[model samples]
Target: MSIVAFDLSRRLVAEALGTAILVATVVGSGIMADRLSEDAAVSLLGNTLPTGAILVVLITILGPISGAHFNPAVTLVFALRRDIEVNAALAYIAAQVAGGIAGTFLAHAMFDLPILQLSATARTGTGQWIAEAVAAFGLVFAILAGLRFRPDATPWLVGLYITAAYWFTASTSFANPAVAIARAFSNTFAGIRPVDLPGFIAAELFGALLAVAFAGWLLAEPKPPTTFKAAE
Candidate 1:
């Protein structure tokens, strides 16, 4: 269905539900990976694969409903581009953050882990911060570039990018403010400490802004040249 076919409430629900599922996949897969694998590399691959696959499915399913923006950084970028209204963008961000938290709790329930616990995982450093920025920048850039050039390929592009980022980035590419906040609530393998939230969030926002600026310039429509009659 097209975006115009869905109302605001439906769109909000789609956003919340999509984000919830996405976070559940990320956290749940991480937990399962850690349990099943003795090798850190294997565990990371397990976590990365399912998260990327689920992202492709979720985006394909929910994109038309809410633009499939499971990240607040994404919502902000769209708002900055005037693609979505400010009030609606605020609503979307709220839905995404709340859904992300709820998703963590759901994963905990499924795994019989504590539902409410702060992460002790200390993910902080200059390198980590830069990685997060780089991750976020690449994520937004891939999205904007895909949407502009080949909207049909966006899901696959995003999935592939995240899968690669999970390996390449020091921070494993949280790349999303809402996901980072939700991750802080979990003590699982994918968790990030609450203390490190500010740095990650700041870097992510800056990265998204940079993507907007860069994409705006790179993707701008060409203007028609003014014609001058030759001494008519």
Candidate 2:
């Protein structure tokens, strides 16, 4: 295959695999949390830890393969930053949304709660909105900086950033639209309300876009010699 064609195929396969892993981890963690404890804090940890761990591992594993976008908003930010091609970004985003829906259904089936009321997300008012914005900005900034200027630092840095965001952010650090949508199906401990999904996703995506724009303006173009290095 030509270089461009090979790159295209790799991206699609990576999106499929990354999304599968993301949903599996998210749904699996929710099921475990439901069975383990009813306390909100314990449940939070149970859900966040698994998701964080999975994200860390998957980003490390799939970052080179597909930039480990795993989320539609992330892809949007990358596209806006001109780090990814438009067509590929659209394809990745579509894959993410579809994967999220599939993941939610799978989770429902696995838990024998096909109509289970997921732990839908709902954080309204000014304070909650601010919190969500901050969380999304931090997440996208970390990803952009890590990928652009410090590729070698991604694995652990990305993991740690997500873990911290989960604990600190008021929205429980959703940071990912696809994951948010997928979590709505579990209804066990980490589901978001379908009604609230659109607004929350908008906030998160807008925040990420702002971050990408700011990062581009504030930071130098990632024209460092290493930027040209091939993904491993």
Worst 10-residue lDDT window for candidate 1 reads 1-10
TM-score of each: 0.96, 0.84
- Choose the strongest candidate by lDDT: 1
Report clashes for each candidate as comma-separated counts: 0, 8
For model 1, what is the error of residue 154's alpha carbon versus the real structure, in angstroms, after optimal superposition? 0.9
Which lDDT tens digits does candidate 2 get at residues 57-169? 87777777777778888888777667778998888887887776676676677667764455644555565566667878988888768767787777667677877887888
The sequence of per-residue lDDT tens digits that candidate 1 reaches over residues 1-232 is 1244678899999989988999999999999999999899999999999999999999999998889989999999998888888999999999999999999999999999989989999999999999999999999999999988899999999999999999999999999999999999999899999999999999999888998899999988888999998995
